[model samples]
Target: MTSLTVDRPTTFDVHSPATGTVVGTYPSHDELAVEAAVDRAHGAATWWRTAGFAERARRLDRWRAEITRGRDELADLVHAEMGKPRSDAKLEIVMALEHLKWAARHAEKVLGPRSVTPSLLTLNHACRVEYRPFGVVGVIGPWNYPVFTPLSSISFALAAGNTVVFKPSEYSTGVGVWLADAFARAVPEHPVLQVVTGGGDTGAALCRSRVGKIGFTGSTETGKRVLAACAQRLTPVLMECGGKDALIVDADADLRAAADAALWGGMSNAGQTCLGVERVYVHTDVYDAFLTELLDQTRELRAGSGDAKIGPITMPKQLEVIRRHIDDAIARGGRALLGGLDAIEGQFVQPTILVDVPEDSAAVTEETFGPTLVVTRVATMDEAVERVNDSDYGLGATVFARRHGQAIADRIESGGTSINAFVAHATIPTLPLGGVGASGFGRVHGPDGLREFTYAKATTRQRFPSPLALTTFTRSAAIDSAVDRLVSVLHGRIG
Candidate 1:
């Protein structure tokens, strides 16, 4: 990574949130630069689409291999730029690779032309449907899980035969550039994947550009802005906004397992995960026991730059939001079961657990996006389901009931749910990941993900003509009366 900041007007410095040191420098791409990138992508898309599924698969496999070979270097940059533990960074890379492979392997079957049975009215016609590339897609990614999240869209988009112009979060610009460069190494024929680095302005420019589609991952407010920009040209958009995800615990749930999963889900990556468990609704029957186990596991956990299990908050400004949530919870008569306001130390925030917090508090209502959890007790699983569904953001969720986990998971108004596991739905390559309602729309994995980047093209061909020629001018009156009698005979079965 280049540490020196070029004294140019179109460049900015990227600093490590944990160390407060300059990590790399990236260009502050403007509207013109973004437009140029999209233009290049259009040329790439033309060649890429003509490259046949087999050849595209071969190139995508090479790209995946290149990423695997350089995984360590990419992981290191992820850690340095986003402050996630090196292990977590590697894990994200691993997941991204799996999805990439899945996309490459399954794109043909998912998007290739397939014959469809026509309706009775068009029985003489042969109908078929196929998904075609949207030419160029603009992806605006988030900082958290920088490598995995963007690739979730980029990989699928490429496999669907579309070129991409990625605008990674300013905080993780180096990682984005690194991934794009790796793709270039594997597929040197054309610029199928490109990265545009900058802040909100560059992202807005990408949305307003002539790209075929936009894939955005950020806050709900930011997602709305992206939609508004894309709406200018009626450009299609796929959004994966952040969520205030919750975990439901029933009396039949494995208390020990739930505690362990909750602690990790709420603290890992400094709790920066959009699907991280920020609110947990536990059954009163086992609330005390569950709390005991959760606190016991949390005792050894710490957050810092060194060998701590949890890393520093990737974005410095998020510290204030975490602190304010904790303060508001405590002021509203919430009891701290673990760390509290004092747990927020400079750049690092130790895991904090607040119990008996009001459901309407900021800690529960808004997305904290930090290492904090608020556990609330409910009388029954019905209440738990109701409370979890009450949120405006319907993203991913977790259910810990051993006996009725799937039933409860089915009722939660979220995109994906993990039964007796945490964030498990996201790791599986066969499942589509996205949110409902304010959590944003569209998916980014599995078959749905592959189709999200492309448009459906339907074709019809006349196999044969109908025997009854009702259009003949000589016998039109007689044919019309005959057709009316046939319709009445076919429909007169009603008693």
Candidate 2:
């Protein structure tokens, strides 16, 4: 594996958790090299933005074809690097390809020019708004859902005519490199998309680089630091941070369906997903039934290396955090219905289900980022909603209400909520994907994601002159008085 040198002797090793052997070693990039990469990206960005949407779309389409053709190879890389099941790896790649397709197909319509009404003050002028690409975008991706999360930013940015400099999580560097290689084959004329591999310092350097915008997806604490670094250069950023999302089950909910959805959402990818369901609230009347079904469904899950239902935790350090959360819950008088801390052996953390965990416990409040969930009971639907909304992170929520699904979903304080489903809303290409509060700001998956990488430029041209002309220094006080009178007449309220 290729490596970069830093001031200090820093190194990262990728190990096969299933086999307990070193897979690869990568070096940390020094500050100087990072600066050089940013400079190169600047020049490449100018060329990319000049290519226009038509050319860019063609390139993106070709890249999509490349990914589609090599889906198995890419899936294998994902499975080897992140330890997700082969099926799940394939799903991630498919989702990424879907995003690429959506971005290419809709870029022109979503970001094309639109007419805007010129206010009375500028009556003589016609106004139009269009999106202008940011020069270069710096993307810092996470390990969980490596392809899907990073491509969410990368594809949209490219569609919006912005170049991308991606730094994938150290755990998934190989996948990142493969993605860049595919893009290079699609658009060999310019280095519009490039990958920089390293650790935290490398990511920090990207934030401080001259990139026009930064898109980071990771922990909330790390997001804050990234925001601070970007602030130094006044570079805008889109932060997709940690999430402790909840699943709310109403009295009328289908317990079996809800249990199945929650199990897949919480335990898939070993619970490393940012929008993974961490906490579940069920109405007191049906809490026992829901708990029973959830526990039974989760207990059947197996985490291993070979063809299993789920794979081992990719980041070894996360194993300790998952163990800590299980330990804390067990210590706080919570009962582990299925697996516990002891279940976390090596990199495989057995699916865990905890009941009666205190609301104040770390498992409930903090992001476990593991295959464990806490199920709680609430007396009323209102109480369930309140509990789900009480957290600092509001990335996504799930509502399992047969009758009032949409109403309950709308009331939740989250970016996206799935009614009668878990994370199904995110698959819809039209709806935006992001979070509020501690889950961080900005979006990454829909028309909103495409616009995030561009700035709105309003242009005005004089089509015809109106009776009232007020934008020039030649305007008289009499005209201003007439305009004020018209404004008052239109908007004045009765006393």
Candidate number with greatest lDDT? 1
Candidate 2, clashing residue pairs? Answer: none
Best candidate (score: TM-score): 1
Residues 247-300 of candidate 1 have per-residue lDDT tens digits of 989998899999999998999999998999999999999999999999999998
lDDT of 2 by residue, 4-40 (tens): 3455646678766567676667666756767767777
Q: What TM-score, to 2 decimals, does candidate 2 have?
A: 0.95
Mark the regions of model 2 whose C-alpha exceeds 4 Å error after superposition.
1-11, 464-467, 471-474, 493-495
Give the range of the ten consecutive residues with the poorest summed lDDT in model 1: 1-10
Q: In model 2, what is the error at residue 139, expressed in angstroms?
A: 0.6
Candidate 1's TM-score reads 0.96
Reference-based lDDT, each prediction: 0.91, 0.87
C-alpha lDDT (0 to 100) for residue 385 of candidate 2: 85
Number of clashing pairs per prediction, in order = 0, 0
